[model samples]
Target chain A: MIRKIFVIFAIAGLIMMLLPLVVNFEYKDSLNELSSQYVRGSIDDLKSQNVVTSVIVSYRGLDTLGEVTVLFLATAGVGFLLKHKKNKNSLRKASELLQTSSSFLVALIILFGIYIFVHGHLTPGGGFQGGVIIASAFLLMILSDINLKFNHLILHLVESFSGAFYVVVGLIGLLLGIGFLNINIVPLGNFGQLFSAGAIPIVYSLIGLKVGAELTAILNTMGGEQ
Target chain B: MTLTIIIILGVIMIAAAFGAIYFNKLLAAIVSAGVISLLASVIYLVLGSPDVAMTEATIGSGLTTIIFLFALNKVRKENKK
Candidate 1:
């Protein structure tokens, strides 16, 4: 009836939409000219083993900084909306096994988060991914323990300092005639080494700290702990 | 083989999307949505973007699920009050 007709039409529409993808299956293993140039230049320009990190933290630093600001604004908006008026403890206490295991895992999770961001320039992970991992660890901690409190002061300090320092580094690059947010200000160490990728690692680490703190603060505020 | 895997994952994603929409319980729906996000991460991994896959898995599934649960709890509390 009408339902069957609707389903038929929906399927037809979906098939029509996806027809182009199947018909135009031209997947290229090699980069296009522009991307090939970027790939070749990145080694000499940024000296980062991970071209993705070089693009994200160094080439597109300002854009990433803007994204971070948007996140900061979003977290601030949430805090304003969900700010607790009365400190009424509402969360039920989790079980003993959950509590003990969560506490034990928190440190390990934090360590992993740090590792992901610290090696961002040399690995597939980066600041945003690592920051979310750290925030998830805090989320787990929040779930297991009802009475646990976060040090908001430390979170704020980390957020502000990292953001400011990111800008400061960019400004320094601008002053040094390396263009804004360029990694040329710092010497590109031997490639593939942890110390390589001038300014990329430092920027990503700062970004990781800032993002981790911002997300943790948002979670705390949403959970009515702030 | 890869095409078959992609087709299977796509089916699962569609099924999860339907479950998220049709489930009566809010918690069930949220969990279903998380499953959809996780399946998407797997697809991203298969498509040769491990970094995007990791981000989608961690943020889209992990943190978003918790946030939705918190919001659901708040809504339930307010409804009860």
Candidate 2:
């Protein structure tokens, strides 16, 4: 009874504290100075339609690099913790419906994932989202076939190469006297074009491939595929 | 109209959160958690952030749920052995 009363009081106190903020919240009608600058820079300088993508891939590139490293560490930790032991006896096969649908859907899903990252500067979707979508395709295959064996060599190669290329691209920018990870390493083509975002798409594509390969590796490790 | 939809989604999300806590079955709880994430993605879309919405839907709901299910399956198999 005391515990329940304590919970009630805690809840009430929290609501009392938060309710004033909710009621008094002022909705902003315009972008602040920093946001307006970012918006302008994204369009005028980067020639990128998606302001968010430019900010993530160019302006804050090092932060994103750090984020990718964190994800790699997580994948490494999961792989370390989960021992890859092959199950000798096969479990019951997945439903025919699942097997048929997944096989048909995997290619389409992967294509969509590629399109997302390739057009990251022009669209709302980007590298991380595309990478997760690609990972989902592998996950679907794993769900359909428990005995499936993934080629670790190819997965590792893709993951490592993409990561190395990302850093190399950044280095190229630094060597060119542009700030690190600057998108002006190449010609900023006609605005709103697929190739207009300079190095943003390339960086995003590398991120997508690296993220996809790392996630697939994690899934493969967890799924017990050697 | 948008406000109404947002309100409804918020309610459903809260209900799902409670359902996740209330459910005894681990699978049901996981499903409830996924529901919350899926609805949050929708809310993010309604708020005009499609990038965030896609990330939330894919990573938060899709991959996380599958990972949880895989973990649960592994635990159940070990228990059986």
Candidate 3:
């Protein structure tokens, strides 16, 4: 039946998707050996607040840049999914209690999110995690049944600007002959502290802001009525 | 041994997922798929990719369930007498 055909096609698709993993096995051993040495140097030099961020922004920065672009594309695509039709009264009125709690929660979340984003250079999480937390706060607002519509103008401004800044940071990397996103041009700050990793944390914060805005816009676009 | 264990667990997850699909209840099938995704994601974690594992669990299970629920509502409405 149609279901059987669908299953067959899905299996075929999965096989194709997994082909790369199998192919990559050939280099896995050699890659791991090389990384074992690099990992030691990274720890010594970067004294990174988070090992993952250091790896992302230092060792494998080029890949991180590509990953950000993927996220950017996803955000853009999802943005279209939640396109606004311009109805001021699209959502229902928010109860006073809901409004109070939502405002309280949103403020708290934004504050905590900022803390997380700033401390990313010194802590476990980076921009992406904090950004998602911020977006979730906005999603909470959307769920509060508030008729308050987010200003598309403000979101568009923030999104476009942050994305531009991300690329500019990469351009700085290019200038250093480090391809895209090499953070070595800027002084690597003290290991295990805020304001460290120079441009990496700053770029991460920009990514956070852009991601938070984009995700919130997407969720808002997919409103309750839709 | 590790590979064998992973393969065994993955097979079980896939089998359980198939069982869910074979059943008539859409919710059951969706829940089973979620379980399978979680299991496969854990394998990814064992292979040293917590990020990919997190994404697999989040998008594979979380977003998928939302989408299925949305479609389920539409289907039920279409079938209304």
- Per-model DockQ: 0.75, 0.80, 0.21
lDDT of 3 by residue, B26-66 (tens): 88888787788878888888887665565576556655565
Q: Name the candidate that leads on DockQ.
A: 2
lDDT string, candidate 1, A1-226, tens digits: 9999999999999999999999999978888987776677778777787777877887677899899999999989988888765657666789999898998999999999999999998888989999998988998888888777888889889999999999998999889896888887788898889888888889999899999999998888776443
Which portions of model 3 show Cα errors greater than 4 Å?
A1-31, A81-100, A176-179, A224-226, B1-81
Chain A of candidate 3 gets a TM-score of 0.77
Worst 10 residues of 2 chain A by lDDT: A83-92
Query: Can you tell me the DockQ of model 3?
Result: 0.21
Range of the 10 consecutive residues with the lowest summed lDDT in candidate 1 chain A: A83-92
- Predicted candidate 3 versus true structure: per-residue lDDT over A65-175, tens digit per residue: 677678768767865764544433433477788777987899899887777677776765667767777876877777676565688899889888998888888898798
Residue pairs in candidate 3 whose N, alpha carbon or C atoms collide under 3 angstroms: none
Per-residue accuracy of model 1 over B1-81 as CA lDDT, tens digit each: 778889999999999999988999988999999999999999999988888998999999988998898888777777876
Q: In TM-score terms, which candidate is top?
A: 2
The alpha-carbon lDDT assigned to residue A88 of candidate 3 equals: 36
Q: Name the docking class for model 2.
A: medium
Task: Compose the digit string of candidate 2's lDDT tens values, residues A39-111.
Answer: 9999999999999998999889999999999999999999888866655644688899999999999999999
TM-scores, chain B, all models: 0.93, 0.97, 0.79
